[model samples]
Target: MQCPLPRIAVLWSALLFGLALSAGTTPALAQAERCPKLVAGNPFLQRLAPRTVPAAYVAPRQVGLTYIGHSTFLIETAGGVTVATDYNDYVRPAMVPRVATMNRAHSTHYSLNPDPGIEHVLKGWREDRDPVHYDLDIDDLWVGNLQTNIRDWRGDTIRNGNSIFVFRAADLCIAHLGHLHHTLTHDDIGALGRLDVVLAPVDGSYTLDIDGMIEVLKSLEAPVVIPMHYFNESTLENFLTRFAGRDYAIERRESPELVLSRETLPRKPTVIVLPPGG
Candidate 1:
């Protein structure tokens, strides 16, 4: 997976600059304490084993994920905390989410009138204000973000205009690539910590190119990668074709939902293709 060095260099540079100007979401240096990181380095990186080895045995600590079409997903945590990603007027979860995360790349990615019942509305970008950062540790879940830049409608760079939202729960971390526009930098990877699962935009046009998106996914080294923000089936298939017999196994599921747990992730790095509209 070779990319043009010059293009990558530019993308990396812009992100570094964005981080410098952005304020207080993640510490500058990755904590000496890494998040259950490094599949090879830390024994804790391995998923917590289930109580029994029975075929039907389920993990005690688990998260339920349902794809709600486009980039929106309904994430239900064990403690009854519901989270909606890329919450917008066009597509939303059935019920109001306790927490909502939105990106401003397009009207479809955000809403002007989000539900007032939402306990926490995490806006990924702000206009004429410093980028927003969050470190919310609540019942059964922890949410944080690393800031990144995005391209506006006219193709102008908006500094600190996007965020990579990370949700930590039940000894696993999941990241959503909110309208991500560039390949990640070394510092970006370090700050993001270990990612067991990633929700990525694979449109290869509106977001980062397919190559760069794949590059970002590989750099994070998450065992589970799920595709989102694709408009049509062909677009989704094109992204899957690139990985067909390569680094990741492709699983096409009939259901557009998943139950993720440290004990239940596939042993191999896999691209789980959940159909849209759950």
Candidate 2:
């Protein structure tokens, strides 16, 4: 897992810049404090864990997420392994990801020729009738996906054509809804278990309608939801407007990247709008 030096430098610079912008009087100390030392499992994640674990807990790992325009996001784990979700030709992270997840609902959601440097390439769909399934562990990071359907170019129904990629690391379960065309059924929800964060498509017309996406969000009830796949400000605003007077709070950020740990998660359900790139 040797990452290109230029890519590592770029990510480090962006991270330091974000740290400088924090609302603390001493930026250096603030950054140091917010960036916790290496730990095992996040304590806050215990709340969402299944009943199988023991009562004691270790500190969770820290992970960073960077929006790379459209539906592509770079997810970096504390162990240094990285994953790109909904990878396509139009947008890609500067660094070659250790793993890449793809959904072929549209040209923008997948790439036919992924880089050879990537260790694992997970496709959300398959030409065969069998469902696309993935359960991969890249170091401490665990990645999986749930099958979903999509509409073909001729608007014909294609079953099990899309996937909602789930990343479990740092003691948190983060889900990316890739080109989702419909709402989740009882079984879909059951398979998803619990999601701490969700990256959702908000194009309204292209994927599920705004109302349907809203319903899907309500069903998951994740602590943090990030909007993606929207084309213009109007589309984004329309999606945000629908959440008005609801239990969700909206916050627009100037940067495309953010680091997250269970300890830093918001207490309430919040919609965070991140800029399009690092």
Candidate 3:
């Protein structure tokens, strides 16, 4: 359900969720960083290279992720849990997602009138400056948020206006950076724990600059990195150029969906280019 966490509360959603909570970069995230139930995001821990998404949903120990243009992505878990990241009215999943996450950057990043079918709606920002905490554990999936500040069009900063949603599924930990405006801090990286996959924004000016975003990715050290939120091929290519092919093996996917499992993860860090549109 509908779990309205205690206002001004940190990782205290136990009343409804009864699971440990994490809200983007808040002190509460340290809890999830230490939770044993969460996935250990080490792609190299497995053997063969990753596999692709099949027509059928993923099997146990596998997660299917589909990019729905812009910053939205549909995350499917082994237990049939569906999570829509950066969910907005303009860009959304073909089918209604079980959980919808939104940021306060703009209308394109969130929807005021979300579908009632969505069982959980996690908003990144609050009216006050306090960061929002969400620790939703249903079936075999766990979703949490890391709140970060964003710069408005007026060049002013909105503290905790954006969030980086983390999804722990099967044996993979996937992170989606939502409307991120700046580089991360030391504490920010520590709270994120280890990430197996990262869906990052590559539009230099609108989001973080290419170099800064690269630093953030390097810090997370995820084996697989997917590019999103870029305007055109030029910008995406520019960001890809920063990574040396020797260290990061770049691959292009024909489809927008990716089926990932610990046993199929890459041996080294890879920057995957998934076809745009879900």
Which candidate comes out best when scored by TM-score?
Answer: 3
TM-score of each: 0.81, 0.79, 0.83
lDDT by residue for model 3 (189-246), tens = 7667778899999989899998899889899899999999898999888888876554
lDDT of 1 by residue, 87-200 (tens): 999999888988999998988889999999999999987786365767676555668787778888899888767878888766778889989998887767756767889999
Q: By lDDT, is 1 or 2 better?
A: 1
Overall lDDT per candidate, in order of appearance: 0.76, 0.75, 0.77
**How close to the true structure is residue 242 of candidate 2, measured as C-alpha lDDT?**
98
Evaluation by TM-score, superior candidate among 1 and 3? 3
Q: List the residue pairs that clash in candidate 3.
A: 24-145, 24-146, 24-147
Indicate which candidate wins on lDDT.
Answer: 3
For every candidate, C-alpha RMSD to the true structure in Å: 8.3, 15.7, 7.9
| TM-score, prediction 1 | 0.81
